[model samples]
Target: MEKTVCELFAGVGGFRCGLNSIKDKDFSLLSETWKTVWFNQWEPGKKNQWAYDCYVKHFGTSLDLNGDDTTNVDISIVDKNAIPNHNLLVGGFPCQDYSVARSLNGEKGIEGKKGVLWWSIWDILKIKKPPFVLLENVDRLLLSPSKQRGRDFGIILSCFYNEDYFVEWRVVNAAEYGEVQRRRRTFIFAYKKNTNFAKSLNLENNNSLISEVLEKKSFFAKCFPIEKLDVFSIRKTTISGDLADISDNFSFDFANSGIMFEGSVYTAKTYPVITKSRTIGEILESKRVAEKYFISNDKLYFTNSDSTHSDETKTELSSEAKKTWQYIKGAKRKYRTASNGHKYIYSEGAIPMVDEWDKPARTMLTSEGSFNRSTHIVRDLLNNKIRILTPKETERIQGFPDDWTATGMPEKFRYFCMGNALVVSLVSRMEKILDKIFSEE
Candidate 1:
């Protein structure tokens, strides 16, 4: 059976491309592996919805593609029955406040300041009741809303539990599994009560359920194999049924990996056994790059006229430029004042200024351009010059086709789209395992 999929928050088809493009034994493309029946992509408060434009341009506009504001457009009002029954529902929901980048605020989590897109997903699950569900979000979701840890994730698990779904999740760093960049995102795979995987969760071995689910039967366990968990390290807890209670008092003790079924969450630490990977240099496109893409020597410095030496204008020292780069990468202690008139010292550890060609590139940020500290800097090995990665290279790092998000829009949005995207290879790996599991059932 050809597995059908409904992609929500489909940012230019990362999940679509990954699932639809299966590889043969010799690495040839297989198109009929999975079909994307329905998809939705919309950016709130943007007059020029480039993300939707790019998606429609690439995948072609159809009735199945909902380009409207998902939050505002009620699915029930607009054709609840219009959504085709799909075998799987997949999405990389917006990770706004769920990210660690946001400072601590007591009033945050599932019902935070931003839109509650999770409720929209929950609504869809209730309507369609897909046998399988796959979702992606920032790893910070494991312990969010600094005041109440794990409340956000707990609400999500409880939603699934209410639907009789058995869920397993792991924080996967794509580079650890041989992907091009080091993008860490939490992936949750759930099986409804009717599925064999879910049925197995009810087996009569109370002591071994967690170990069996994580080490033997879970989808992620099969795709990204992990080291055995120490028996003592395994933690088990019964989550409260009331989300309000969990929201106020939930502890953030979830390990890097875990499973939640019924009302209990079983978790433990696990390590990845990375076998192979591609480095930054392997995805470079020097021959196809334009001269403007490289940072010019003139732009790297400034000139200062010295009265002491009228004949010579002191050129901005390369050391000065290097110092700026060092500051961005190095950690330092500094006294600061908060907006509330409180004073304190702020500090953070530094990262490598330049990404290494021998290793995978660092995770990209929405601001992937010159002067952005989170942007990747590469020293052109051929010319010994430094420059930010091109939009095409950024796409390549996320395993998207070059110019995949290039829909005649400005280049900056391309970076923003890729920054919010999930690694295509990661989705493909999970889809392959999912196909096998579903086929057997």
Candidate 2:
């Protein structure tokens, strides 16, 4: 029998896709979907990929109630008896409470709903007892204020330590791995005591171990425009830099030190820093900018002390129009673009930064964070307006193949899908170490 593998919290199967190259030959059974699912009649949970038509079409519909034969099985699911014995388990667990980008709002550890998923993964590991386990998550998981963040991670370590598995972790930036994206995630690897890692586990041996894999080079060295950029343009973007150095008051254990990474050989690009506290919705142009509007009283009044539309009828109309504008603006949210090219403007809180090449991107989400469907974007050499990256662009930034997901899915669906994907170059490197571990020993 081939080595069995399983994926949890599969998220459009990014882990599955990466493992495909391995499982195709060395591995046999693959398990995904959810676990403890006793009956199909219990209904699919939100986390189950089965609700997605695209998932079924790609991975084949799951019929197994849990793991045993109902029909086919979702890679995300498991039933005690149906579960397959696997040599490896890999996945990026969900992270919301542990995410620094979100408001802590009284949450501290794995106690929150999203945070609790870690326990579930741990449970499965306890049951299946795979020889190795790989996990991915936002780097922030290392230190969260509730002390809960640190506690949870510590618990994970203790769990593995007691199970006779050795654990190793490294924070990897996608940019460093080869993709032009500034995405960063933490990789957690665990190996059973008997697994002979040999030189593969030797962090210094990455070069020697990956020579063959990197040789088949077929990626871009640098992203367009970013590779050949004028620093003057960026210099011009500064609104105001303080002359006086501000003293920082807060002290934290893990000081923020980013090591932007880029890939070697093909498919290379500079990682544009993810713009923080901004959004991609600001690229929209404003249409109405009048300093004043009309007002009315009593039976009806209109205009201001200096306006010509002070006439009673004009006043009434202006008042009505202003009110109408408010309603329309509220309904339209940020902007209203008509097919004829007319864009209706609405009131905004502050000018939010839109994602553009000329500018860095907004912060990335763990999985279902904001702007899940849009990428941070800025202008280019041309002055024309642009939209955030579609799913296809996201795939490239994540080091996924151009045809990363099967074609024909709606752009919105794909965008969200790609946003949840991992940076392949980083994870791929981690996987290479595993490959060598098994091959050598």
Best by TM-score: 1
The models' CA-based lDDT, in order, is 0.72, 0.42
- Candidate 1 residue 113 Cα shift, in angstroms, is 7.4
lDDT of 2: 0.42
RMSD (CA, Å), candidate 2 to true, equals 15.4
In model 2, where do residues sit more than 4 Å from their true spots?
A: 1-3, 21-52, 61-78, 96-115, 145-149, 198-363, 366-375, 380-384, 403-410
The positional error of residue 342 in candidate 1, measured at the CA in angstroms, is 5.8
- Mind giving the per-residue lDDT tens digits that candidate 1 earns over 1-441? 358888888877788778765222122234456766777777766778777787777665445334433322333244544566788999998654421112255455234333667766777788788989999998988877667777778877877887878788999989999998888899999888788767755643364766876876778999898887666677887776555566556666677898877777888888898857799988776654566666654443333311111111223234454335444455545566899999886666767766878999888877786566688877765675677788888888988877777678888888888887889888878878888877866
lDDT of 2 by residue, 1-441 (tens): 133456666555566556543222122334431221221211135443432444344464344324345423333344534655567777787554422222355363223234355655665677777777778887776555354334334445445654656554545555433346656676676666556641233322233322221222101111111223222221101011111110011112321111101111111112333223222222222342122211123211122322222222222244454432122222122355688999765433322333454332433543321332222433322334333444444555555555445546555556567666776555554555455454555
